[model samples]
Target: MTAAVRSTQQVFNLPDLGEGLTEAEIVAWRVAVGDVVEVDQPVVEVETAKAVVDVPCPYAGRVVALHGSPGELRPVGQPLITVAPLDDGADDAGRAGAGGADDPGGEPAGHAVYREEERAGSGNVLVGYGTGHGPAGRRRRRVGAARAGTGRRAAADDTAASTAALPEGHPTGTGAPVPTGAPAVVGDASAYRSRLDGELDAPLVISPLVRRLARERGIDLSAIRGSGPGGMIRRADLDARTGGPAGDGRGAGLAAVPDLRPAATAAATDAGADAGADEIVIPLRGVRKTIADKLSRSRREIPEVTIWVDVDATGLLATRAAINAAQPDRPVSLLALLARICVAGLRRYPQLNARVDGERGEIVQSGRIHLGIAAQTERGLLVPVLADVQRMDTGALSAALAETTAQARAGTLPPARLTGGTFTLNNYGVFGVDGSTPIINHPEAALLGIGRIVDKPWVVDGALAVRKVAEISLTFDHRVCDGGVAGGFLRFVADCVESPAVLIANV
Candidate 1:
C-alpha cells in the first residue's frame, strides 16, 4: 500500500508596509479558511500608521488558516495566512520515505512542492515580498514510492547528507542554499526537523524580522523553544522568554532599570487611586498613536515660531467667484486659491519651502513643491500630498485637491500618497475657527493655516468698512530661517489675498 504524505502548507507573512512601519492592524479579511484564493488576490485589509491598504496573497491555494483577526496587530514578516496547495495529496510517511535513499537528490518531497508553488506564484510584489519567475515549460514531478524501513529520522539523515555533499555555489532544494548561520525558512512543519538536522545549527525560523528581533535583543535562538508549528521560532517565543510585551522587542533590558522617583505619600497615593477609578484610559494606537508620536517628535526637535496676520480676503473670494462664473463646471475653491498664493509665496521665499537635516547640519531646499493638504477623516487627520504643485495651475490644483480630499475622508488614499510633503496647507476655516497655530508637519519647514473668511470691520483704503477678512498663521521651523524670511512670506501671501493682481503680476 502507498503511504500518504502530509500536504505542504505555505505561510504568507505580512510584508513591509513601506516607510519602515513595523506593524499593521488587521482591518478585515477577504478570504476565510478553506476558501480558494488566486495569486495576487487581496486576502486582507490592513491599516498601517500611514494608510489603509489591501494586502495581496502571493500564493494561489486553499487557505488553511488566518493568522490574525480584524483590529489585531500583526508584525511585519509574521504569518498572515497559511495556505495548503490544492495539488498536494500525500501523508507524512510517504513524504519521509520519498527523501530517503530511493531519491537521487535526497530532497524532501515537501520542498519540491514549495518550489513548484513559488515558481508559479504571484508576480505582483507587495512593498517588499514576492516570489520569482520560473521556467515556462517546467512540469512538477510527483513524489516517488516510499522506500521501505525509512522513517522520519532516516529521511532527515539522507537529506542532510545530500545537502552536505553539495559543493559551494550549487543549488539546494530551493535554488540556493541558505547562507550558513542564517535562519532556515521552512514552509512545511514536516521539513522543519530535517532542516534543523542539517550541518548548520541555525534555528528553524521563517521570518527575517523575528530573527532580527532575536539578534537585537541578544536572545539566543537555540536556547528558546519555538511555540510555532513544527518547533519554528516566532517573535512571541522570544518575547515570552524575555518577559516583554509581544509587540515590544526591548525585552527585559528596560524592566531591569531602577526607578529612582520618590514614592507618593500615603494620603496622596490613596487620593490618586480614588481619582484613577473615575478616569477613563483610551489606548493611543493606529493613526492616533502615529500622529501623537510625530507631533511629539516635532515639538521636541523643531524650534518653531508662530506669526499671524489678519488679511482682507474680499478680493480672493471675488477672484474665486469670477473664475467659477467663467468655468461653471470647474468651480475653483477658496482653499485652492490660497494654495496658489502659498505656492507663489514659496517661489518668492524658497527658504521657507525647505527642511532642516539636523544630522547633516544642512538645510535641503526642494526645487519642487509637494503640497500636503490637511484633511480630517473618520480615521484621523491625513495629509495627502499633491506632488509637483509648482507645475500645476489653479484649476488643476483645485481638481486634484478635491479628489485627494475625497479619498482621504473616505479612507481610500494609498500609503504612498500620504507622505513626501515639502510643505503643508491647513484650512481650519471649515470648523468655523478663526485661527490656529497649527503644528508643522515634521521634517517639513513650515505649515500655513487659514482661518474662516467672515464679514468683519476692517480698514480698507484708510476707511472702516465691513469686508471679508481672514486670519492666516505661519508656523515655521526657526532653524530653517529667521523671522525676516517668515514675515516676508506671510506678507506676500496677505498681499495676494488682499489684491489678486499681486499674484497675477507674479504669475
Candidate 2:
C-alpha cells in the first residue's frame, strides 16, 4: 500500500532589498498563515532607511507561518514565512517501490527528493525581495510503499545518519543530497524519466539563498562563471566571484560601506561626542536617512558651481497680474511662470538636462523635460516629479503643480511620482528668501532657484525706479557643462523675467 507523504515546509527568508540596507521595520503584513498566495503578490510593507517599500512573496503556496509582527525590525536572511507546496493528485505505490529500499530516512524509499531547482518566483524584485525570475513549472509528488517495523524515531535516526555523512559546509535540511541509486519517484516512471531528461538538458541555477546572498553583496550572479555540474552557481563559485563570504558586515558594521558624507560633515557628526542630557538625538532612518544619503552623495560626487543674477522681474509680475485680471477666479502662481521660463531656458541650453553616467562614462541628455518641483511636507522635503512639463501651457502646468504639491504635502505621493526627473525648479522665493544657493538634486545635472520677487530700487533703461526685482540662482554640475553653458542658461532665464516678450516669442 502507498504511504501518505507528510508535507514538507519551505522557509522563505527576508531578502536584502538591493539598497544595501540591513534591516527594515515591518509596517504591515498582507497575508496570514493558511492563506494561499500567488507569486509576486505583496506579502508585507516594510519601512527601510530610504522609503516605505512593499515586499512581494516569491513562492506560490499555502502560508504555514509568518515570522515577524508589525513594528518589529527584521534583519536580512531571517526567515520571513513558511510554505507548503501543494501536491498533485497522483497515487502510484508500485512506481514508488520500484526505487527499492526505504530512503535513508527509513520512510517509503521511493519518495522523490524535492529538488531546489523547481522553486519559482516572479521576476519583479523591488528594492525589497522578490523572485529574480519568472514562474516555475508545476511539479508532482510520489507516495512511497509502507515498510513494516518503521516508526518516527527510526526515520529520524536514518535522516540523522545521512546528515552526519555530509561534508562540512554543505547545505543540510531541505538541501540534503538524495541517496545513491534512488529511482525517480513518480506515478509514471517513463514520464518522470522524460521530465528529468528535459530538465537536465538545460543548465540550472537552483539556490534562492545563494541568489539573495549575492544580491546583498551587490554581486552580479550572471557574470559569475559557475563551476558546479551543469554550470550551476555554487557557494565556492560565488566565493571566488565575491572574493569573500556572503556577509558584507552591513548588519553589524557601517564602516565597510562607502561613506555618504564628506570629511567635514563626518567630523561634524561627532561634534557632540559627549551628548548632553538636553540634546535629542534623531536616528538617521526612513525618509530623513534617504535625504541625507542622496544630498551628501550629490555634494561629494558632483563638482557643482552656482551662479546667481538679480533680475528686474517687473514684466514677469505684470504678466501674472494681467493673467489674474483676465481670469480672476483662477489665479496664476509665480512658481508656474518660473517653471515655464525654465522649460524655455532648458530648450535653448539642453546640455543642462542631463546626468553624468560614471559607469558608462558618458553624459545622458534626456529629450523630455520631466521637471521636479521641490515641496516641503510635514514629514520632510520631497521632490515630486511633474513629467513632460514642456508639453503643458501655463494653465495646465499651474494645475498640475498645485495638484502634485498637494499630494506631496499630504504624504500620499507614490515612489514613482518622486523619481525620473531631468531638471528641478526650486522656488525658494515662496519662503520669502532673497537669494541663496541650493543643493543640486542628484542625477539631475542642474537646479534653478527662484528668489522672492519684491519691490526694490532698480536701474532700468539707465533710470533708478521702484520695480519688482527677483534673484535667480542656477546650480549645475561642472562635468555636464562649463561656466559658459550655466551662465547662458541663467542669463536667458533672467532675460525672460525682465522681458516676458522673449518668452512669448519662443512660445
TM-score computed on alpha carbons, candidate 2: 0.52
Clashes of 2: 2
Residue-by-residue lDDT tens digits, candidate 2, 1-507: 233432345677887665467887775565544344566665666666644555666676555567887657899889887765544222223323543443221223444423233348755655223334222111112112222332111223333433433334444424566443211112222222232322323222344334445654566765776675335566556555644323433464543554434322432332223222244355566677788888999999899999999999889888999999999888888889999999999999999999999999999999999999988653466798999999999988999999889766644455667788999999887676899888889999999998888899988779999998888899999999999999999999999999999999988
Error of 1 at 267 (Å): 35
- Candidate 1 steric clashes: 6
How many clashing residue pairs appear in each of the predictions shown?
6, 2
Winner by lDDT: 1
Off by over 4 Å in 1: 1-6, 86-119, 125-277
Best candidate according to TM-score: 1
Each prediction's Cα lDDT score? 0.69, 0.65
Model 1 per-residue lDDT tens digits across residues 407-441: 67655576778789999999988777899988889
